[model samples]
Target chain A: MTDTLLEIDNLSVDYETGRGDLQALRDITFNVNKGEIVGIVGESGCGKSTLISSILRLTAPNTRFREGEIRFKGQDLLQVSERHMRDLRGADISIVFQDPMQTHNPVLTIGQQMLDIQHRSKQSKADKRAHATKMLGAVGIPDPEARLKQYPHEFSGGMRQRIAIAMALMSEPDLLIADEPTTALDATLEVQIIERLQELQREFHCAILFISHHLGVIAELCDRVVVMYAGAVVESGDVREIFHDPKHPYTRRLIECDPGHLKERARVLPTIPGEVPDLANLPGGCIFRDRCDQALARCATEVPPLDQLKEGHHAACWLNHEEATS
Target chain B: MSLLNVVDLNTSYGAVNVLAGVSFSVEPGETYALVGESGSGKTTVIRAIAGLAPAQEGSVTFEGQEIRGAPEKVMRPLRKDMAMMFQDPVGSLSPRLTIRSLITEPYRIQGMKDRDLDTEAKRLLEMVNLPTHFADRYPYQLSGGQARRVGVARALALEPKLILADEPTAGLDVSVQGELLNLLNDLRERLGLAMVIITHNLSVVRHVADRMGILYLGRLVEEGTTETIFNEPRHPYTRCLLSANPEPDPDARLDRIALKGEPPSLLMRPSGCEFRERCPFSKEICTQTPEWEVNGGHGLRCLAPLS
Candidate 1:
């Protein structure tokens, strides 16, 4: 059996704004193995979040699909009906957002929120309660019996994050997408939460599509990585290769951007020195041409295809780093 | 002499106690960072020291003056000697004002209506490594980083003896974070100003702060020289926080300290150590308020190295 759990092929999304139709993602492709942790790294507004929402068909109004497909287990997800997508959400695929406040319902108790997620697919109310309690236990939450009865406000931010994680796992979904899970959390709590998440992913053998801007998180958790910029995949490789041997100019800039990484280099890393291009009026050439350090005359007119640098390592930068060698 | 001294301080918001018996000090040229998570009372300590949140108990001495409950007249003069930078740049800056006007607001407060506020504002903007032309731009037009520089320029308008920065670089990018940290350190060295930086980022302590204090809820848990705390921190909570930070080096894997339970609420504050509820090394006696052990001028609040 193919170990690949999810594959996103040339997926793109557009939204109508005051500026008109904005293509947020372009020709993005990646895959995740059944039990592997795959990270999507990008700057803000790089279409990382929009990419996840498209898979769930959860994109808000005025957001239209431009092209491409999302396949989970060789079945086309983009073609799935809205009712089918709803059924698959809590059962086969799940997602956790950056904001705990948004993920949780203030009016409902944590048990109610979690139990309710799976009740439509499940039978027996008391049986659902037992599963919720077991899930709370699995997430390393304290006082599972009592906590299930209390409202979301009664819990601390860290506790609420645990509840959100437990809620996502309640259905035993094969794939879990967590978008910047630790962004707003305290450093200590963020650590605890990531640890619990990795442990659960292992226990369930669940594939995780981990999205974060922090390379530190990717190094610690992800098995592989896909680097995004200006609504395109700039680089994709194993976590080690992407971090240590990045090929794209954007990839190098992102790695060298970290204070810890810059400590070893002699000169300070001058960040890419410009904002991400407006997707609505993208350059005819490579999207990163405006900010690329080694842009040549060809780079200003020719869009670089995703060229292979090594086995399973790909970069879209026009610079032939491989040609410089053997 | 220590530039600022806060002893047995307590401050509240309406009916809720924000800071309880918080005490710390900053030497004339040192940067003392108060490190903690949100709602851990880091900002409250800054507020209490600045007199924005008037302390209901204890004393705050700036340059040996016991000026806890000074009247508006007395405090207004002190404002020239102390300045503050808030966390959110967009909200902190007056939305309608241009960057030039925002930077010179402090000068206007000090009765400089006749002086060349525009020229002085340009100088302040240039000092923070911002372009001279940036002064003409509105706060809304500036990016997150540019707005922060404007904020810093405004904070420096008074030429204060001390600067209190609350999460100065919280929302900024990684590259921008380094520039701001270096800017704060450079400003401190060049101007010989005392600084108290309040932030949740522990990495800042190593680069900018001379001394560091870890706050849990409203109580200060661990404190010491930056080298001491980062190398041999005795508190479990401190260890957990440091480990949780994404390691700069990709090769090093952090064995995160597992804090299984939730941190206790401030309303029902713990009887002893505020961290005892979630600490990995909590003992029976940790249920009692521990004394501050001052050794070699390093302080820690714990019944640690115990019997």
Candidate 2:
């Protein structure tokens, strides 16, 4: 088996706007190895969602694929036909969205929904129910057997999210993409969900692409962390290494701004001045230049490439490039 | 006298009893954080204080004067001294109204036409670190952070002595959230204004709060200084909530406590302790309303002793 499970190379996508095409994902390149948990961290409008959609070919009608290849299990997913993609979606690749309520059918019983999705499994109806109950129990849902009869409204928000996770894993897909699954949950529930996800990952051995803006969740669950700013990946490295010694200025600012790690009652939290740049009228050179604290004169004219800072660590910044050249 | 004191505040919506004998007080120039999960009645406590949600039983004394069950005319004057920032900025600000009009609406409501509203509006915008040009734009033209800043500006129109902000940083980016939090902290220090911040995030509590009260099933389960709550929590729920908050530092080892599920609905709320169903350390005594164990400034309502 190949070590890499999913590979996204130079993938660029744009959305059709009134004036012209607005670039959402620009030359984004990354890899998820077999059974590895990769985290994508970025602010809103940073193209994290676009990147996820690109993997499943679920981009909007206005979305235009400008460049790059998305290879899943050595086969280019972008080149696959619609029929083939459909088979691959839930069977080989599954996703858990941020809002579980939207994903679930409010009127249907949990068993009915679970059984409907398992038609492709070719298992007996009774067998499917057994598997569903087991998966739900694995996700820390109590009374899984009795819960199968309950409607979506019967469960609480956190429990609904857990049921969603259970449904996502019922197929035992090779790759799982969770887009801010715990963002809606409380802090305590967030911890429970992340820990449960970690435990499930170990048991299932599925490659996970976990996307979140919460740094603490990323730090706790991810083996590798990818930091995105604007529409591009600003930095990527091991979770601990990146958290301890962030290479990119944007990554540094993102980490420093989090109040989760503050040891004392902070008098004033350090803030990044200015607003996120308009994606339609993006600045030249680095996308993060306008809000970046360490932008140089050359940053206005030259776009920085993802330069290697260390083994398995890379940062896309002019400062890093200059340091390497010097 | 305390700036705001809520004693045995009990509120209910028709058949559902939301808050059951909730009590807390905020001193002058203090930042009090009320935190809880969804359906814990954190927002209800704030709404109760603002007179939006009237308490069925209890007394809310502001500056040593009883405001609960007060007449509309009596409450009208007090509105000028207290302002509230809603959780959803987009919903809080009217889409048709320009930023300037929104900020000055409070002054216009109080029938103060003599004041220089135009200048006051500009100063309010600047105080929230929003650009002067944004004053001309409608609420829809602004982003989430910008709209929140406008909400803060609107909340400060009457120069309120006590500010009640409900999740001021919700749905904002990391940097923007930090900036808004710092702005609130700075404003509190500059104006010596007391605040009651209602939120679900413990991180925000750690940053700006002086004291914090944890609510469960509309009851304040624990209350103490932020330092004491984080370092040495006596309540099982408080300890679980603190440990459940994932520390950003990867090196820190966390011992997480797994609760059964979310708080039961208000309709199906357990008799004694609202948290009895979900508390891992719950015992038979938890079925009865636990007595408040007070020590120094820290206090918790629980049957189980801290391990």
Candidate 3:
């Protein structure tokens, strides 16, 4: 039997806006297995960030978890105390944000910040410093000892991002939430970061919930993919299956829209012909029906349940559901 | 004659030399792309060409007229034949202005008071496939894609022969980015406008650019037709960049030529090849600078080019 690291079940989230309550995430469900990289792919306003925030129990003041549970190690994280959550944060889970320029304290040296993250550990100062140096070296930083003494601003953009990843993995957490960690880097540097992450993940034996809008990066790194649209999970399957044979119309269109998939130079690239619906006043059907090309008439009145099409593959679309049922 | 020709363009900010003798030429109705990593002076090349950033030395000829060091009075009339689209979608637009005033502000700036702005605004919006009613909305009311369309509309207000676009498809969804690319391609063909696009996205360069130049440390490492460069890249840096770009297909080969270390700082550039530090094919001969060699239509500055 496969070991499940984290299970998010039927989670729903809403934001209190001036006009009305904005439903950011609706009936979201996914699971990360031990030592597996799962990617969450979606466009802006599709609640990718909101899903990350909800898992860390770090929602904004004007937000509320409408329903569902985030179970980690068989215990519901939503039912945990603030103190318990705080203890579990760095020790059990950690995050690397998009912009490394803002990830660290400007005044603090890299060595100081690295040691500070390991404050929960009872190890001696010398041991922690040694660990920090090794971690920096693992991320391919040159002269780890001298580099640790320097400030974050002294590092280049690629180096800063590498250092950020080093700091996040210092505790050797079970799950690492990389929220567009390589998005800010250049193409060459992005490749380096992805390779380093792959190496580091294998060494640390930690699961990764990689979230990004770039389909190429997702395809490169993720083993399984969870495609989100309009604050809902439209498709979740093996990376190969999702890219090769996408069942949901939204997933198919998304893959087709990527410029990397274009074999020849065409005058007009295919595009979805509509905008994302307003979250405050959602339509009474599939969240993606407005932009979905293969949307059926039934899709306008009822939301299709996530149906199992094949082993370890699921898609939420009326067309897929009919195909599976038939 | 070429539509625009920039020969040995050199731009420097203080002691740091940003663009070091970069040169390229664009024919009328041709689309050329400047591709590079950040700090590689892709934007600065266009800025230098537009005279927004002063060039230390170079010859920029537009329509057979010398514009390199032309005075403001002489350059003022040239502005009507050239337009620029800034990188940011919403940030580039004036926040207080309505869509109507924003797109037609070019006419006002040029002191062309004889034309009716409302009709011009409607025409520009229709050209960009946006509803004419959008002219009444403010910049804040539009989405990223819509704001980009407005930027395009503003750039096309003067009906320029040449357009300089910087990261036109950035900060949009895949579908939205495709829409913008299609719009740009359609407009370029319909207007027969020559364009110089600056972006790091190789996919975008492949889609729209007829020819492309790969820049490293403010110098063109390689220049050739986009099809040739993608198929048979000569420079190690160009090959690395092409291989590094993550292809969306899962079945595509993942044999990435992982570049080592970060790009060296401009303040203390490495001797000889600037890309040698990260290049996997660096040899002893790479210590000395390679000549910019051109054969047929392809050119590259490399001591040991890929066969």
Best by lDDT: 3
What does candidate 3's lDDT look like per residue over B1-307, in tens digits? 9999999999888989999999999999999999988889999999888878899898999999989878888888888888999999899988999999999999998999998999999999999889999999999999888999999999999989999998887767889889888888888888899999987778888999999999999999999999999999999999989988898987898777877777888889899998888899998899998889999999999998998
Off by over 4 Å in 1: A15-23, A60-62, A260-272, A289-297, A321-326, B12-18, B94-101, B116-143, B248-250, B267-278, B282-289
For residues A30-95, write the lDDT of model 3, one tens digit per residue: 999989999999988899999998889999999989999999887899999999999989788999
TM-score of each: 0.89, 0.94, 0.96
For candidate 3, what is the DockQ-based docking class? medium
Q: How many residue pairs clash in each candidate?
A: 0, 0, 0
RMSD of 2: 2.2
**What DockQ does each prediction reach against the true complex?**
0.40, 0.75, 0.79
Those runs of model 3 whose alpha carbons end farther than 4 Å from true positions after fitting are: B69-71
Candidate 3 fnat reads 0.83
Rank ordering of all candidates by lDDT, starting from the highest: 3, 2, 1
* Reference interface contacts recovered per candidate: 0.37, 0.79, 0.83
Q: Runs in model 2 with CA error above 4 Å?
A: A322-326, B261-288
When just chain B is superposed on the true chain B, each candidate scores a TM-score of 0.94, 0.96, 0.98
